[model samples]
Target: MRTAYSVEMVRAAERELMARLPDGVLMQRAAAGLAAACADVLGRVYGRRVVLLVGSGDNGADALYAGARLARRGAGVTAVLLAPDRTHPEALAALRRAGGRTVPGADAEEPLRRADLVVDGIVGIGGTGGLRPDAAALVDVIGETRAAVVAVDLPSGVEADTGEVHGSAVRADLTVTFGAHKPGLLVDPAREYAGSVRLVDIGLAFPGEAELEALQHADVARLLPVPAAESDKYRRGVVGIAAGSSRYPGAAVLAVAGALRGGAGAVRYVGPAGDAVLARFPETLVSTGTPEQAGRVQAWVVGPGAGDDADAVAAVLGTDVPVLVDADGLRLADRDAVRARRAPTLLTPHAGEAAALLGVAREEVEGARLRAVRELAERYAATVLLKGSTTLVASPGDGPVRVNPTGTGWLATAGSGDVLSGLAGSLLAAGLDALDAGSVGAYLHGLAGRRAADGAPVGAHDVAEAVREAWRDVTD
Candidate 1:
C-alpha cells in the first residue's frame, strides 16, 4: 500500500529529523535527489537548457542547488528568481560559481519559452490559497511552451493537503517529491497537475499511520475473498440485490452480473425485473418481492434503477446485515433510518448524489472530495464511498482513508456504477468491513473497466463481464 501524509504531519517529521541532522544535510539530500530526477528526465544533462523558477523558500533552494549541479555537468542553467533579495544566499553563490546565470522573475519570458526543462519551485507545502498574479503569469508562460516542467516537492499553486487547485497552478510533466507522498499528489485536481510523480526519500520518519492510503495489487490480493475448500454455497455468503424496476430492468441484469463475478456463493435478486434478471443470468435466484421475502442473504445492495422506491430501500436497511445504498436509494433512503441501522451501512454516491445528500452544490463536493467523504461518513455514521475518476472510501473511524487509483474515464458510462454497487455488496456479504469492501470493489471495477475498454468504448455489461478477468489479474 502506498501511503500519503498531510503537510502538518510531514513538517513535524521534517523538523524532528532536521534537528538531529547536521546543518544543510537535509537540503543537500533533497538537492541531490532533485538533480538526479532532472537528469533522468533530460536523458542527457550536457547541453540541456534548464530554467529554474526560483522562489523565496526551500523549494527554490532545492531547484537552485540542483541547477548548480547541472551547470557543473555542462548544462546551461538559468535561475529566474521570483524573489531576488529573498533567494537562498548560499545556493545563489554556488550556482554563480558553477556558471549559472540569474535573472529577475519579470524578465523570465524568453528563457522560459526556449528552455528544454523548466523547474517549478515557486511554492512549497506551506503555501495556501493560490499563486500571486506574477507567479500565475509565469505559470501561463510555462504552459505556452513545450518545456517539460519538473516541480520540486509538488506543483506550485495547488493545496498540498487538500488537492485543491484554486486560480492557477503549474502543470508538471514530472514531480520529484521528497520523503513521502502528500495527500494532494495522490488525489485529483492537484494530482492531474502533478502528472507522473517520483518519490525522493530524504530519510524523514513518520510516526503512526498515514493520513491517506492507496492500495496496490498486493494489498488487493491480500484482501480478496478466497473461498475455503469446505465452503458451500451458503458458507461462502449470498448477496441479495434489491434493484431494477419495470422501467429500467437492465440495472438488475448488470448488478446481478457483477454479483455473480464477486466471489459470492450465490446472488439473490429481489425486484420487479425478475424476467430481465433471469434472461441475463439464469443462475440468479430471482424474486419479484421485497428483501425480507428474498430468503437468506448475508448482505443487500439497494438501488440501481429502483426509481423512487424509498420504502423498498428502507426495508433492506432494516436488516442487520451489511447494506450498500446507491443511485435512487441514495436519494430516497431516510437518513434517520440509515443512521439507526445496527449493521454496517455503505453509501456510494457520485458527486451529484452526494451534493443532494449534503445539501451542497455538486461542485463543492467534487472540489473537496476528501472532506466530503469524511464528513459524509461521520454524518451518517456509515462508510462513505465517493465515486469518481479517483474513487475514495472513508469510514467513521481513525484509520487511513483508501484512495483507489485504478479508475479510467470510460467508467463514466451508464450502468457502470450499478456494477460497482453489486461487487461491493458481494464483498460486504463475504464479511469484509465497509471500507475494505468499497475499496476492493472499486479497485476491481476500475481494473475491469480498463481491461474491457482497452482504449475503446465499452458498455456497462462489458465491464461487468470483465470482473472475472480483473479478479484473476489481481490474484495472479
Candidate 2:
C-alpha cells in the first residue's frame, strides 16, 4: 500500500528528525535528492542554464541549495529571489559561493524563458489560500515559457490535507516530495496539478498512524480470495442476490451476471425475475421465495431493481449477514433500520441516490466527490461507495477513502451497477471487510469493464462475461 500522511504528521516527522540530526541535515538531504533528480532531467548538467523561482521558507532553501549543487557541476544557475531580504541566509551564501547570482522582479522572466529548466519553489506546506499578486504574475510568466517545471514538495496552493485547490497553483511536470506522500498527491483536483510524483526518503521515522493510503497492485493481489485444496462450494462462500421484478427483469440478469464471476462458491437468486436470471446463467440457483427463504448465504445483495417492493427490501435486510444495498433499495430503505442492523452494510449510490441520502442536490455531490463519499459514510454509519467518474469508497470508522483510478466512461451502461453490487457482495461473503470488499470489487469491476469495452460500446452482458478475464489478470 502507498501510505499518505497529513501535513501535520509530515511536519511532526520532520521536527523529530531535525531534533536528532545535526542542524540543517534534513534540508541537505532533501536538496541532495532533489538536485540528483534535476541532473537526471537535464541529461548533462554542464553548460545548461537553470532558473530557480525562490520564495521565503524551507521550500526556497531547498531550491537555493539545489541550485548551488548544479552550479558546482558546471551549470549556469541563477536564483530569482521573490523576497530578496527574506531569502534563506545559509542557502543564499552557499549559492553565492558556488557562483550563482540573484535577479530581481518578473524581469527575471527573460532568464526563465531562456533556461533549460525551471524549479518552482514559490510555495510550500506553510502556504495558505492562493498565490500572492507577485507570485501569480511570476507563475504566469513561467507558464508562458517552454522550460519543464519541477515542483518542490507539492504543487503550490493545493490543500495538503484535502485535494481541494483553493486558488491558482503551479502545474508541475514532476513533483519531488520529501518523506512520504500527501493526500493531494493521490486524489483529484490537486493530483491533476501534480503530473507525476517522486518520493525522497530523508530518513525521517514517523511513529504515528497514516491518515490516507492508495492500494497498489500487489496489495490488491494479496487481498483477493483464493480457494483452498479442501474447499467445496459451501466452504468457499454463498452469495444471495435479491434483485429485479417484472418491470426490470434485466436488472436481475445483470446482477446474476456479476455474481457468477465473483470468487464466491455459489450464487442464490431470489425475487420475481428468477427465471430471467437462470436463463442467462444456469449455474445460479433460482428461488421464487423471499431473500430469507433463499436458504443460508454468507452475504446478501439487495435493491438493484426491486422497484417499490417493500417486502423484498425487508426480507433482504432482515438477514444478519453482510448486506450490499443499491438502486431501488437505496430509495426504499428505512434509515433507522439500516443503521440498527447487526451486519456490515455497504451502500452504493450514484449521484442522484447520494443526493437523496445526504439531502443535497446531485450537482453538489458530483462537484466534490471526496466530501460526498465521506458525508454519506458518516451519516449512514456504513461503508459508502459513491459511483461516478471517480468512484470513492469510505467507511465511517477510519482510514483514507479508497479511490478507484481504473474506470472508463464506457462503464456507464444500463445494468452496470447491478454487476458492481453483486461483485462486492461476493467479496463480502468471501470474508473481506466492507471497505476492502468494496474497493477490491470496484478495482476488479473497472478492469472487467475496460476489457469488455476495449474502446467500443459494450452491453451489461459483455461486462459480466469479462469479469473472468479481469480476475485472471489480477490473480496471474
Candidate 3:
C-alpha cells in the first residue's frame, strides 16, 4: 500500500528524527535528494539557469540548499527570496558559498522568465491558506514562464492533510516530497497541482497514523479471496442479489452478469426479474419471492434498478447478511434501518446519490469527494464507496481512506454500477470486509471496464465479460 502521513504525524516523526540526529541533518538529506531529482530533470545541471522561489521557512531552506548543489555543479543559480529577513540563515549562507546570487523582488521577473527551470518553495506542511499576495504574484510569473517547475515537499498552498487546495496554488511539473507521502500528493484538487510525486526518504519513521493511503496491485491481489483445493460450491460462499424490475429487467441481468464471475461459489437471484436473470445466467439459483425467501446467503447485493420496490428493499435490508446497497436503492434506504443492520453494510453511491444521502448538492459532493465519502461513512455507520472519476472508499474507523488508482472514463456507461454492486456484494459474501470488498470490486470493475472498451464504446455486458480477464491480471 502507498501510505500518506498527515502533517501532524509528519511533524512528530520529524521531531523524533531531529532529536536523534545532528542539527539540519534532515533538511540536508531532503535537499540532497531534491537536488538529484532536479538534476535528472534538467538532463545536465551544469550550464543550466535555475531560479529558486524561496519562502520564509524550512521549505525555502530546502530549495536554497538544493540550488546551492546545482550551482556548485556549474549551473547559474539565483534565489528570489520572498521574505529575505526571515529566510533560513544557514541555507542562505550555503547558497552564497556555492556561488549562488540573490535578486530582490524588482529583479525577480526577468531572471525567472529566462531561467531553464524554477523551484517552488513557497509553502510546506506548515503553510495555512493559499498563496499570500507576494507569493501569488510570483506563482503567476512562474505560470507564464516556459520553464519546468519543481515543487519542494508538496505543491504550495495545498492542504497536505485533506488534499484540498486553499486558494490559488502553484502547479508544479514535478514535486519532490520528504519523509512520506501526503494526502494531497495522491488525491484530487491538490493532485492536479502536484504533477509527478517522488518521495525522498529522510530516515523519519512514523510508527502510527496514516491519514491517507492508496492500495497497490499487490495489496489488492493479496486481499482478494481465492478458493482452496477442498472447497466446494457451498463451502466457498453464496451471494444473493435482489435487483431489477419489469421496467428494468436488464439491471438484474447485469447484476447477475457481475456476480457470476465474482469468485463466489454460487449466486442466488431473488426478484421479479427472475426469468430475465435466468435467461442470462442459467447457473444462478433463481427465486420468485422476497430476499428473505431466498434462503441463506453469505451476503446480499441490494437496490440496482428496483424502481420503487420498497418491499424487496426492506426484505434485503432486514437480512443479517453483509449487504451492498447501490443505485436506486440508495434513494429508498432509511439511514436508521441501515444502521440497525447486524451485518456489515457497504454503500456504493455516485455523486448524485451521495449528495442525497448527505442532504447536500451534488456539486458539493463532487467538489470534495474525500470529505463526502468520510461523512457518508460516519452518517450511516457503514463503509461507503463514492464512485466517480476517482472512486474513493471510506470507512468510519482510523487509517487512510482508499483512493482507487484503476479507473477509466469508459466505466460510466449504462448499467455499469449494477455490475459493480453485484461484484462487491459477491466479494463481501466471499468473506472480505465491507471496505476491502468495495475497494477491490471497484479496482477490478475499472480494469474490466477499460479492457472491455479498449478505447472504444462498450455496453455493460462487455464489462461483465471482461471481469475474468481483469481477475487474471490481478491474480497472476
Clash count of each predicted structure? 0, 0, 0
Q: Clash pairs of candidate 2?
A: none
- Put down candidate 2 lDDT per residue, 30-98, tens digits, no spaces: 999889988988999999999999998898999999999999999999899999989999999999999
* lDDT of each residue in 234-327, candidate 3, tens digit only: 7779999999989999999999989888878999998889888888799999988778878789999989989998887788888888999998
lDDT, model 3, position 385: 94
Compute the lDDT of residue 85 as modeled in candidate 2.
89
Query: Which whole-number lDDT from 0 to 100 does residue 399 have in model 1?
Result: 77
Which is better, 1 or 2, measured by TM-score?
1
lDDT of 3: 0.90
Candidate 3 ranges with C-alpha deviation above 4 Å:
453-458
Q: Give the alpha carbon lDDT tens digit for every residue of 1-476 in model 1.
A: 89999999899999999999999999999999999999999999999999999999999999999999999999999999999989999999989999999999889999999899999999998888999999999999998999989999999998998888898999999999999999999887789999899999999898868989999899999999899889998888999999998898988888888888888899999998999899888999998777899899999999999998877898998999999999999988888999999899999999999999999999998788888888999889999999996888999977799999897898999999999999999999988988999999999999999999999899999999899999999989
The stretch of ten residues in a row with the least summed lDDT in candidate 2 is 209-218
TM-score for each predicted model, relative to the true structure: 0.99, 0.90, 0.94
Which pairs clash (backbone N, Cα, C closer than 3 Å) in model 3?
none
Model 1 RMSD to the real structure?
0.9
